[model samples]
Target chain A: MSDNPQNKVKIEARDVQVFYGEAQALHGIDLDLNANEVTALIGPSGCGKSTFLRCINRMNDVIDGCRVAGTITIDGQDVYSPEIDVVELRARVGMVFQKPNPFPKSIYDNVAYGPRIHGLAQSREQLDHIVESSLKRAGLWAEVRDRLSASGTSLSGGQQQRLCIARAIAVSPDVVLMDEPCSALDPIATAVIEELMEELRKDYTIVIVTHSMQQAARISQRTAYFHLGNVVEHGATQQIFTNPKNQQTEAYISGKIG
Target chain B: MTEPSNPSARKAQLAKRYRAERRFRAYGIAAISTAGLILFFLMGSILLSSLPAFTQHYVTLDIDITERHVDTQDLANSDWRALARNALRAQFPEVSGRKEKRALGKLLSIGSSDDVRDYVTANPSSLGTSIRLPLTLSDDIDLLLKGVIDRDLPENERVVSNQDLAWLDRLLDEDRISRQFATRIFTNGDSREPELAGLRGALVGSLWTLLVTLLASFPLGVMAAIYLEEIAPKNRLTQIIEVNINNLAAVPSIVFGLLGLAVFINFFGMPRSAPLVGGLVLALMTLPRIIIPTRAAFAAIPPSIREAAMGVGASRLQVIMHHVLPLAMPGILTGTIIGLAQAAGETAPLLMIGMMAFIVDLPTDVTAKATVLPAQIYMWANNPERAFMARTSAGIVVLLSLLLMVNATAIYFRKRFEKRW
Candidate 1:
């Protein structure tokens, strides 16, 4: 491991392995997400990119017979420590899934759910402020401000994703993990989400898993390519796409190997 | 172009297929209608046979109660039986003539003093005042009024004596006895004599029993369902629990009644025929019914919403409370209402729990002797008086109407809360 003192790492996963019953999903993988930067994990289907993302927030715990091993920490705090409160750990490291899964509630309630559950907002006005600021940070307030009480599901696909982003940020999490956040979106919506991620990196550490290499090139500063449950290459996004050091990475970018 | 050579043959084939399809559809319709017809006929027969019970014949009398008739001194001394007898003799006005008084006394109910004593004790101020009391007609008179007493039948086949029928007919013509709508059937309690019985006491008992069943079963069933569906770990134990719940739902309701009899009535030593014990038993029988549907409702909730909540940094408890529970509410309510309906119709379990008790008075509390609607119908069906058949049918109507209301509410709630996602 190279000691880069100037780079402030928010999350570090060391030698992580994941399995679904006897089937190994993610091999020993090591990675770092720096503060105020977008790190994208890009790969083809079944390459365990999404599985690794789920491991960061321990979302894999919900899957039957799925086990994750090795040390994953956020700001030097072991997320899987026995004393760690999963609720609090989730509060600190939030996630956004592939599909825009808004709660079956009004837009306002969907965004305010986290803060209310964590007792972060003392008054209704404070909760409203949190919702507004989160939505604003997600670049959705301008489009949805007039209908905050409308159902979150009433929004367009892209807007629902942004609302989910706003909901994730509402709890003031330090790191935001997204798994194929724009897979279900149209081109215009995908561009909007890509842009939002760029802006979101200024205030939050963002780790995104995407199938679109162009998306990785457009928004990500750092990128990791995985193949067959192993990290093939990881470096600055431009270098990995333009001049990858590994043959597998080069073949993948050249449309030879997925 | 090629088929043009065989247009007639193709047309004939298509016609044959259409005929087969029509026959298939007709069979489906016939099956559905057959089931519906059977249900309709059963209900129709029950209503048709019990219509006569709603009307009753009674003898009305104007009796003068002088200070000497209902002796205030005897009543104050709690000599209730003497006061009741004296009041009965005064109403006849034949006590001066021993033979006439004896005949009048024979015509009066042996238990008439119980009514007098109840009335006098309830209103002590009316001891010396004149009052009009409508005494219930004898069971024989009631049967004759209902046309059940066939005087032309052979003596062995006839249950009511010819003398009594003749007496009743003469009294009816004299206007001393008359047929009136039996409103008391809706206001009085059960009795050994079906002619004197009503559904008022049973209705109250059923209402109280259902109240307890609802209060106990709904929250507990819903909570257990939510936990099992949304929170509980997927393991052998949970699997066992799920299987047991499904099995319990299919268990014969009478088995639950037997269980109640053994555990609640016998082992617990709870008051026999009390709504409290009955409600507790019914709630147990209803729990599996409620829980299965509620869990299914919760399970119908897509995992995407749960993931969304967790992705938003909300805890599992928060996800369930804020999102899962609300979405599942409609199903939960539908299940609960259906369970209540099932419990309402259940007679076997209630019979096992002593709801067949011969309660002669309206229950004042949950612990008092009571009879539910089904049990009341059962009792009325066995009455020797023919008039009770009508009352039983009327009771069945009330029971069916209540079941319909509950089912309608379930459908309404299911429609109202149905979610697309």
Candidate 2:
């Protein structure tokens, strides 16, 4: 550990509440994501973990009747501010969905989509280099490099997910949010992605939502447990797994309550 | 595992079940064959009855184009009529030998020289050219040639006299009588006489009307569907719009014609029988059909694709233009083609707007008086001549071919744009 206070917090959420029409989905919740570390949010279905992840990038804005309230800031800039452009904000905070959603395009175009949209790479050569390096970093280049023109959907399920990851990283975002990125994959593909995430954390702050506690322990440096729309506890992965915490957190980690 | 039983009883039960199965299969086969038989009968009847209309018989004459016969320069002493009579006598010596030369001249329609006079006067450049004009054969002669008028019938009962029949047979034996495919049916204008009728005017009118309908309906339908499916809030107003669109699709086509009459022709004072007014009416009828299917296609797209596009920094408009619209293209095209086919087949609404009138010249513009294919067929079917029956069948064939072409185009585009994902 660097033990440096300068790398203290990258993202801060204070008393965030979300609603779908008249029903409340998330209660007021406070959390902080540290810089250059992987934080995993673990919870059961309908526990609002994915909802919280979506709010960070304003993905919930597309849903009809969905309203999010509270303050979320990235690097001291208010993400929920009226002046913030959602498109620019999303370009900064990229996301990978739960299911593998490789666009109905060639593998090369899938990764190039983000960079092309954000104007991150100026020329074709720069875009090609970005796609190659991003795919390499996602550990998908070896399997997919020869067939870049083939449809992204023609790949195996695991490769499609990695392609999505590569697409998210190609824009060179500050934070990468993954919503159960490995839930759709087998154990072999899951291990490959976990290794890729370990390498990715060196430059980008990563937040992952997963149902597997073992995965949370293996990949993430910090862990936050959510229950009934509230963050029950959060600490270092080792401390949260092995040491004292709230009873709900203990019960959830021990598999007594999801 | 099998339960032990008396062999004969088991055999009887099996036989009963087999009998029921055989009965069901027989019923299915009978139903299918019945449908096939009905379709074949309908198609065969149409093709068989309409074949004779394709040919028309004409009498060819070698009339010399003498300058004195066509020129009427002397105002007080004009004698082109005497000159035409002399020219007819010179061409057909049999007319001069007949005691009733006047009746023979009427039967041959020698007055058709008036048509030639008008043509030559209008186009003086063709004064020296010998044009083989195909004059309209009289309906009685056409029936006699086609054997629709029986010689066995008494003189008063039969439309053609025995003398006329004998003369027609001699003309046929001399090889002067010839039948050619009726090109005039496609080139000339509508007429009360089936022998002179053609679809040229009606076809032109339909083309103009369809052009207007396509221009006014397609974009408007697509825009309405997009707003309803993609952008509009799900409120009572949206629900009402949805219901109205569906209801409009089921509204009788003639109701739209009434609406058009009351609105466009009466209130707005647009020219009656003009293609513009007819097109507006048909467009109103077709809009709901196109919009409903387009909306359904837009709705079938997965919400995830839209979310992914938006998440990747695409604007709402960009998401729709780049993804949703392309995905929904096949359905939209199908809907449009079906709407066009329905519009092409519609007749009752056009009837209300005066599209059934006998327009003798091709429509010069959208504002010109016009008829359509179905209206033309309807008018021909009601004509007194038996020859029009064949003409009506030919018109049906043309209409069917047009519909087939439209459907084939729709299928081709649907296949081209179909996406597995």
Error of 1 at A14 (Å): 1.9
- CAPRI quality of model 2: medium
Q: Which ranges of candidate 1 are over 4 A from the true structure? A: A1-7, A254-258, B1-17, B58-68, B71-180, B415-420
Q: Put down candidate 2 lDDT per residue, A71-169, tens digits, no spaces.
A: 999999999999999988988898888888877778998888878877889899999999999999999999988999999889888898898889888
Considering only N, C-alpha and C atoms within 3 Å, which residue pairs clash in candidate 1?
A: B50-B389, B50-B390, B53-B390, B53-B391
**DockQ in order:** 0.55, 0.54
Q: Each candidate: what lDDT?
A: 0.82, 0.83
Q: TM-scores of the first chain across all predictions?
A: 0.96, 0.97
Error of 2 at B236 (Å): 1.7
Per-residue C-alpha lDDT of model 2 across residues B385-421, encoded as one tens digit per residue: 7778888998888788889999999999999997755
